[model samples]
Target: MIRALNLEDLGSWLLKANGMTSDIAEVAARREPVRRFCVRPGYRARLMAAGQPVLLWVSGDRRRVTPGIWAAGELTGPALVADGKLRVPLELRWLDDDRRVHRDTVRSDGRLADLEVLRQPQAANPSFVTAEQMAALRAYLPDGCGWTPALSPRG
Candidate 1:
């Protein structure tokens, strides 16, 4: 099992990433959980379930920081809190070698409505990812990698 990490801690990391301050970044959170998203250097944000290499954009716009906003596209994995800093559950996505006993299990939690699999060998991600999954993805972030509290600008 992996040690569960919180978005608050993540924000601290992101502050170091962008050369920002944790206290100020926490202020950027605006009393909400932080969020990190994977995006390409060009700014295209999305990650397929198969673990294909893609650009990642770690973001969080606490009121005390730049942009003071947060946004992104498909977030593949790593610990990203969705509702009020609650842990979102996530299961693995693997291709069946045809030697398995049962189909892949589905993840369901109260904070998130549901993240059902649209494809077998691949997964069609629906909503935001869980905090645990995001932490594991730090390896793929850009040079300024770290945590960033997310604040939605609009729908």
Candidate 2:
């Protein structure tokens, strides 16, 4: 049932994956339970349906952060928002094994270098990525890796 997800419709977004420990990024890349919680309010509707694709960029330790794409996959189910926080159930296809990308290589590209979002990633939450940014990211992906944008249901 999960395999039915259309890759064409999945939207790409950037996430600041730094945590108190390396285990957070490790477990998430392996498609394990990564429960997120927040005690404050100001919740946004992160509408995630079953089979939706998501590109999860994981950053290692704060001391030495890698600058590259990490993992990609479809949402196994809907994202649950309880209390004052959100929990996303993800099914990720691990990208880089060690989970770090070359910062200089990506920055060399004039197109990507201009992107403030990519230049300085927010350490707080996930943000929607533009098509142009996704294109830049795809260019840096490893040879065998594939990232086809999901088609909108409306069209």
Winner by TM-score = 2
Candidate 2 is scored at a TM of 0.60
Q: What lDDT does the true structure give each of the candidates?
A: 0.25, 0.50
TM-scores, each model vs. reference: 0.20, 0.60
What is the model-wide C-alpha lDDT for candidate 1? 0.25
Cα RMSD for candidates in order: 19.4, 7.4
Q: Considering only N, C-alpha and C atoms within 3 Å, which residue pairs clash in candidate 2?
A: 7-150, 8-150, 8-151, 9-150, 9-151
Q: What tens digits encode model 2's per-residue C-alpha lDDT throughout 1-155?
A: 11122324334544445544456555644657433322112232244445544565545553655545566655555556665456556655556555344556656777667443454565344444445656766776655444455544321
lDDT of 1 by residue, 1-155 (tens): 22232222222111111214234334333533233422222111112222212221112342433321122122234334454442212221211223111112112222222211111112212223334333433333323333433322211
Q: Which stretches of candidate 2 lie over 4 Å from their true place?
A: 1-11, 19-22, 25-44, 60-65, 82-84, 98-100, 114-116, 143-147, 153-155
Best by lDDT: 2
